[model samples]
Target: MNCRKVQYYLSTFSEGSFSSDKLSEVEVHIRNCKSCEREKFILEEILVAVRSLPTKTTPDDFNLKLFNRIYAEQNNPSESYLPTPESSWIRRPIGWVSALATVAVAALITMVFLQRPVGSPDLPLNSPAYSQVESTSPVSTPSGKHVGNRIPVSAYENIIGVSGSASNYRATNVSQVRTLRLADARVESLYVEMMRRLGAEPYPNMLRADTRYYEMRSPFARTGSNGSPLLRNAASTISY
Candidate 1:
């Protein structure tokens, strides 16, 4: 065996488990190679030093004391509980200032909203006069139910209209819209099958009944087909 192979087995040999053939190889290499012999001597010294380390001995009451301490921690808890010093009064002012800043931001937002003129033309995106509706009416009514019987959502005070004369004008009503029941599972399945026949993957999670009501306002986009930009159709959870 080469010196490298013998060196590889040298550790195993030191542990007293090398095969006779491997040991012979190691012995021959150590005798013939000074470098291998030096390495062997170093390994022996390391093993001896490691074995000579002072062994830790437990006192007769070690287990009792350890268990008692643990029990005391569990029962009393004072030993483990470190009380942090109360923050310095000077430092507290900064925290108060930060809290005031956050509150001020919130107040500013509320004031901006409240100060906004009702019926003013400015409307934000996704501003679907949802405040007009109170809650989604989950009742099962017969077809052709009276419109007044339906729950009323918040209404839009501001009405957007075309710039020209009344007859030449168009208007977008920002109002909460009721979700369409058309996306029912059966209808969705039919749509998926139709798409499959056309060799297109059905939209991901397409079968789920998801609906959203978009803002009723003139599209911010300058260029689009006539005044009506298609509203985003997606599910909207009305927050009370």
Candidate 2:
């Protein structure tokens, strides 16, 4: 990109927001071009200066004036407060430009520096999402080999007694747990309790209360890395 184009988009780039793909292109241009690099440096220095300046209180009638201005402009499309001769504004720096730039610098500093990135989608404890990753077999690697899951379900979470071979077999997932429903009345009661504890609603939704249908349909739910049953030992009497 040329110096003019680089400088044109520099303000947006500096604010740390732009089209995602423009990142490397802009960075490459800015690093190679001395003039653009210097401009960026000067812009940063100005932002620092603006940050150090004390803030002034707005005029008491600022909002009223702004509303009136906007209303008048809306009524008359030709009428605008922006300078008609923007070329001069671009080529020549004036007092008004200095004030606006100061404001812009301050606003940009707040938006870019102080603003926090959004937190990622989390699988918090006891959430259905947490169960999707938990109580399952180890994740398979690229070479079709298994390393035991480093972030396995917390032992303290369920605290249920496990038969010696339960880990090697038995319900490995929500479907497996769901499959256990109506296998016996006592097991169904226990399943309902487990689902409720895992943030599932009770009652009419009891049969598949805690489980997303998609999870039940997922290939991962079908089998384990080892030959362990993933929802195997199906009950012949599925009342649901």
Candidate 3:
């Protein structure tokens, strides 16, 4: 028999539960194997120590204390299992970071939508009105005069008319002019409002402290120089 068989039968040998033939085989192995003899001695020592240990009894109030703790935890879970202030400090900053990131993303999306072009098929680039509006750049007026950052003369003409025609025009022609002027005023107001909404200054002169041109300008005024409050309100409310 090997040392493995001797160790396996060690417990049965102590209890005298092995047959005579198996006992002879385990004894032969243990007598020849010094390691198996040492293992058997250690197992005997462990059994003796276990038998000598005093029995420990539960305290009379042990069950009552355990139940009370469970009940208290159930009734006031937060107070019983609240995290430390240091752990809360670590978590609060992460929540604030997430909120700030969300706000930044929303702001970026708003900016992108506002900055997107408001062009459409009705306002195609080749259209005369579109070309005229684009050609009326801030470089020069229709009267061949250089006026830096001033409203274009074409825009002014479209709204009010060329100079010296206001008094000579007939009543029938005046009515037609008024209609055109109102339309032009609405367009200019819509442009200015769009620029303002997108966080831009359409004309730098309008922002000047000493400049009263914004109020005097027909297109910029509440009325299109015709005292039309309804037209002014409609212009102001134009959407992109």
lDDT of 1: 0.40
Q: Which is superior by lDDT, 1 or 3? A: 3
The C-alpha stretches of model 2 lying farther than 4 A from their native spots are 57-240
Which model, 2 or 3, shows the larger lDDT? 3
Per-candidate alpha-carbon RMSD to the true structure: 22.6, 28.3, 32.5
Q: Between which residue pairs do clashes occur in model 3?
A: none
Question: All candidates' lDDT scores?
Answer: 0.40, 0.44, 0.47
TM-score, every prediction: 0.28, 0.24, 0.25
Tens digits of per-residue lDDT for model 2, 1-240: 788988888888888898877877888999998999999898888888989999998765454344445435533545775645532554666857765764564465345423433211222345443444344554443455454443234321222111111221232334334323222222223333443354433223222322332223334465434321332322121122
Best of the candidates, lDDT = 3
User: lDDT at 35 for candidate 1?
Assistant: 83
* Superposition error at 28 for model 3 (Å): 2.6
| Candidate 3 worst ten-residue window by lDDT | 160-169
Per-residue lDDT of 101 in model 1:
62
